[model samples]
Target: MAKIENGRKSVDTRSIRTISSSHIDDESSLGSDSEINGFTSDRQTDKYGFIGGAQQYSEESAQDVPTEVLRQREVKWLDMLSHWDKWMVKRHNKVRLRCQKGIPPALRGRAWLYLSGGKVKREQNQGKFQELDSQAGDPKWLDVIEKDLHRQFPFHEMFVSRGGHGQQDLFRVLKAYTLYRPEEGYCQAQAPIAAVLLMHMPAEDAFWGLVQICEKYLPGYYSPGLEAIQLDGEILFALLRRVSPIAYRHLEKHKIDPILYMTEWFMCAFSRTLPWASVLRVWDMFLCDGVKIIFRVGLVLLKSMLGTREKLKACQGLYETMELLRAIDARYMQEGFLVREILELPVTAREVEREHHSQVKRWKKIRGELNFKSPPRMHGARFIMLAEPPRRQDLQQNPTIVVEASQPTPQLKKSKEEKSKKKKSVKKKQPIEEIPNPYPLLSDPPPPPKEPPAPPPVSSEMPQIPQQTLIDSPQQEHPPPTDLSLAKESPLQQSTQSLSSTEQDTYL
Candidate 1:
């Protein structure tokens, strides 16, 4: 029973009246407005509104960035990697401190390799990345990564860019890594990891970082058994208890599990969850602190989840619970508020080792007892559906085409609401006028009727997605989700769903 402040119900019905008047006599904005709804209801690659085209993802000028930019990036990365030479441990230490603070924006690319020690390894070991990239066997990760891609960070601009070039590039880097590390081949988590890499470093450097995963570190993480992914979850849990106890107790009480959420964090190495702007910050610590930061971020996420423990336990399925742990604000969680909580985590090497061994044993034990379903498997498919090649325009802007449904929306009389999509500040989900033939549904209205002229066409500036094949296998699996952009809906709905990701005025 909400009461109106002005006894006369000070509601200004002017806008409403103006809207109906504008539409009844004209064919202005009705279709445009509804088009937006249709857009948001479908899955759009440009989830972050990075590029607003209904087109598929593609590149800008592939002619090249002048070998100079590539060379400069290459030489610079080599130098950065070389700095980790035998005589340069001090240089590595200094770089470590700089990373502790944060890698400078311009230096991020080079710093990435220097931080990962990838540069040194490549310099020290040639034919390694190629060897790993080409080393062949059945890739075990295709299925899991694909499923997670849709949910990993549905809100991030980079991953959600309506199957644009950026998204395709992400897939390429990770796919290459799988080829390079036959052991880790095509894991879902790698997409985000590569995402973080591609954002901060050049493709080559990022590629090497992927190699480094199998080179010295991460043997168990990507090991064949799904063994690494699961066992590490246990190891990470122990690590969290040692680092932050407050987050631990709360998690323990709620019986929350970090296994499901850790997939994204561990898989992408934080690229999937954190904002691109903030990834360098996380990367800085990751480089300087080693693998410990991964565990710390894990604990921090769990600790943050303590607040929603009860609600989390009640989740009907794994997906909802997964999103909750992801929603934890780490900045607030680790601001020294969990000092007491940190004390409760298991810290001793023996203690962790005992738990780790037991956990690993359980993975083995469960093999005979309960059947844990393996993640989805991706068998490369090329031309599984009606796929197309990239065009020049799509390269710069998204090019994904809508697979129109067989049933089209019913045609009705023109209305003012349709005009709203053309307006700059488009809002999604606004109720549409439902009247059936308000003005006239002309079967063959005056050629292209004047009383009801059509609205302006929808447009976008997003990059297009590129087609690719597996490194060694001839199987050409088309990226099912990457082929579509925001075109599936009207510009209005796409813009509205996009706006939710950012706090900005709808200049549309």
Candidate 2:
């Protein structure tokens, strides 16, 4: 028997009986059936549809943001969607602001697709998901995936039944990811992330969304060794020292590892930890702002729980600290309050990057060489140009070529001069002629034709005015093309045309 110190008490590890694999497998197989029969009825569910009594701290209780405000935000998001490329390129700050405010739930899934560049990835890799879905994935990974299927959101109505469509779709998504990335296979943490995506989008879209998360947004997070997360753990610790030194000192005193608490928090992106509403809000910012949001959230939680001496006094040892972190108070998880805290927190991407470099160097110095190799973390959405509104420069360069009727060119000037000379010379010789009118009105005859307005007195030499040319100007070698096809075409078509040949072939 091994004893571990727990502040004022000591606990025997041998007393913690570990369940056998057979027992765990048996429970896994019966999980859905047990949940369905035990408690998952329509009557017994929260507003969010979890098979439990209504939550004490609901989204409404967190902060009752007016419906009109959400509606207005929805409108702004719609506009952003239409001009996605422009927003991503030029007005990304606005995107960040809107994401921090919270993506309207109605638009959350679609916005996630755009924000994560999943839509573009899906468009680029058309039919790939179907191919992967059709094939049988590796048996090894499939078995592991199957065991975890019921474990993900078993209480939710979607996954309550044994082998329900939700579970089937979830399986397809996870299995497809295995085939798509055979080397990494699947991680248990991925199931909840994929489940969250499947709740909002189709299986294929969810698959691509998962791809973006794995490959881009949070690269190397689900790899075999989880080296990226380990590195981030160090980085998070370094940051915590600055953000909340009291919490830092408390953990240091207990000789606690950051991984013990933060693994699930970072790997699952807090889906399992935070309230459902706050989870969605965090995802909104995460997908929009990338992994920095995850770091900030972790720091905020640490600070909120153990920042002050009074809070740290309660967590006397590793056990108490772990317990406090695992079962965070519901008050701290409130959506509005949490989001406000996260946004106000001063953790920036630059700081995260700087810390990452420092930690990487320290690791290399200690370990001799790094073992894992993963792609660089993507900050936000992949920089794909979408159908965007015309830029001010583009509009300025090819302005509407309107030629005023009063502004005569040099060529027209000669003709006008000739006509004026003839009219003056013939003024005495040609009298107004009035033959019989074809349709005479009963009303008094119309007044005689007014004399033509006299031309302005002709100067001996015309003022040296520069010739104004509408088309084929001498100065312009090639006049701007007047196709306006881009302006006329829908945003989608423009986005398609804007794609490079490689991108078109790859995506389209």
User: How well does model 1 score by local distance difference test?
Assistant: 0.46
The CA lDDT of each predicted structure is 0.46, 0.74
Off by over 4 Å in 2: 1-42, 54-56, 59-61, 382-508
Q: Tell me, by lDDT, which candidate is best.
A: 2
Model 2's alpha-carbon lDDT is: 0.74
lDDT of 2 by residue, 310-340 (tens): 9887888889999999988888888977998
Q: Which digits, one per residue and each the tens of the lDDT, describe model 1 over residues 1-508?
A: 3224212122222222133543433422423221222224344443223323322221220112354565565554445444334213335454444454444455666656654555544555556555544543233444444444434343444444223334445544565666655544565555556666665655656777765544433445555555566776878776666665655565556566756668767756666565443444656655554455555556656655643445456544555555566575445343233332333333433454466667767767776532333332111111100122222222121123867657534442233445655453544444443222111112323232223222233335543321211111111122222223332444564344344323222211
